[model samples]
Target: MTVMELSNLSVTLRRRDVIRDVSLSVGKGEFIGLIGPNGAGKTTLMRAALGLIPFVGNSSLAAMPLAERAMAVAWMPQQREIAWPVTVETLVMLGRTPHVGALASPTDHDRSQVDAAIRWMGLDDMRQRAATRLSGGEQARVLIARALAQDTPFVMADEPVAGLDPAHQISTMQTFARLAEQGKSSLVSLHDLGLAARHCTRLVLMSEGRLIADGCPAHVLTPERLAEVFGISAWYQDTEQGPVCQPLEVIR
Candidate 1:
């Protein structure tokens, strides 16, 4: 089943096109890595798909009624800021807001979901800590847990593992992979090509505000494509751990 679809999607900022003529579909149980160089419109495409910005073209998620869309898709933006000093569990419980009406209180199931999300993200120990006091990587994990607690059919994350250690980064990617196994669809923007190659079931490459390639990691992360889109030469090898890609040098 198609969880999200975008057709001819385009976004303009300050009278300049940021994403143009991009079309993509995210299917159920698929983990897609959205990859590109800085300023390659990865974030623009996601914001457009979520209807967070004004854009042209059709976005299925954007067309849904506000409340319905909230249930269908859970989004974690690139910015991770905890302005309030809420406890970790309290922060994660916010994900249940869509399910619980404005005047309604959370049910037992809501609490259970929140607890499970905390454990899933390996944040059980920090559940009682103040969110603002956590490290950047820990905060990122907590935000991901909040998204997981939403229990949406689709998840969209922009640079979700940006500030994590190598181990945490791999663990975070594995979490998304596990979500796919549970029949959730995810579109994650990532700068780490190796992690993207290892964990994502598919890769969508963008360049200069357009979709350049979309396919399995091996097919999309070719040296030629890397050099063309990322301006780098990469050494790629199929390993028991999965496809590994290391940037050898800049093309220029």
Candidate 2:
């Protein structure tokens, strides 16, 4: 089954087109990595999929119309300046809001899910800590936990590991892979070509608000294609760890 489908998707902000004529279909249990340079409309496409932005095209989730898309899709944006001093556990519990009744308190099942999400993200030690006090990497994981608590069929992440160290980045990618293995579809936007190649089942490359390539990472992330889109002279080689992207220098 197609978990998410976008047809002729277009998004404009203040009359400037950010995404144009984009169409893609993500199947159930597929882990797709969207790679693009800054200002390439990766986030805009994600927002359109979530029905957060007004667009001219059609998008649907699980064969349902776009009206109820958010219920079936969970989104984790790039960590921003969050001033709220809520506990990590409490923050994750917020993911249950979409599933709860209006003005109702969280039930035991919700709390248990939150707890499991914390453990899934390896944040059991920081469950009671304030979100504002955690390190950047820790905060990213906490946000991911919150998204996981949603228990949606399709998950979308914007730069899920943008600020994390190498170890944490790998951990987060592995977590996403596990989720996909469990039959959940995940669409993640990433800047790390090597990590995306190693983790994602498919790659979607975008540039200038347009999708340039969509296929297996090994075939899509060639040096010539990377240079054409990213303006970086790079060589891609397969190693024991997976495909490694080596950027030799900037191609001016």
Candidate 3:
């Protein structure tokens, strides 16, 4: 089933088109990695889909009422700076806001959902720690856990794993992959081509505000496309571990 849909989507900011005519669909049990070079409109496209920016297009998620939209898609933006001193669990519990009502307190089900999300992110031990005291990577995971706690049908994240070390990075990607297995959809923008290849069910390659390619990792990360869009040569192959793309060098 299609949980998110966009048709002829375009976004212009300050008289410059940052996201051109692009159409895409995200369905149940799919993990989509939105890959592109910087300034290629990955962020703009996501923001537009979430109705965080003005756009000219049809977006299933963006067209919903604000309250209804919150229940339909969980948004994890690129920013990870947490200045509040709230405990990690308390922070994550915020995800239940949409369901709890503005004047209501969290119910038992809400707490359980937050707990489940915390476990999913391997953050149980840090539940009581102040979010502001954690390292950047840990904070990132906490933020992801908050989104997971939201329990939306679809998730849209921008560069969700930027500050993590290798182990945490793989673990974070695995979290999204697992979500797909549970019949949830996620669209995450990623620069790490290898992780994108290894974990994503599909990839949407963008360049200069338009989609250049869209398919399975093996098909989307083609040598010619990589060299042309990314300006690099990569050695790519499938392993039992998953597909891997190692950059050999920049194209001259």
Candidate 3 Cα RMSD (Å): 0.8
Q: Per-residue lDDT of 1-31 in model 3, one digit per residue for the tens?
A: 9999999999999999998899998999999
User: Taking the tens digit of each residue's C-alpha lDDT, what string does model 2 give over 56-137?
Assistant: 8888753455336557888898755557999999899888888777799999999988988898889999999999999888
lDDT over C-alpha atoms for residue 5 of model 2: 88
Where is the poorest 10-residue window by lDDT in model 1? 243-252
Candidate 1 residue-wise lDDT, 196-229, digit = tens = 9999999999999999999999999998999999
Select the stronger candidate by TM-score from 1 and 2.
Answer: 1
Better of 1 and 3 by TM-score: 1
- What value of lDDT does candidate 3 attain over all alpha carbons? 0.94
TM-score of each: 0.99, 0.93, 0.98
lDDT of 3 at 5: 90
Considering only N, C-alpha and C atoms within 3 Å, which residue pairs clash in candidate 2? Answer: none
**For each predicted model, how many residue pairs clash, with residues at least 3 apart or on different chains?**
0, 0, 0
Residue 140 lDDT in model 3? Answer: 92
> Candidate 2: where are CA atoms >4 Å away?
61-67
lDDT of each: 0.95, 0.87, 0.94
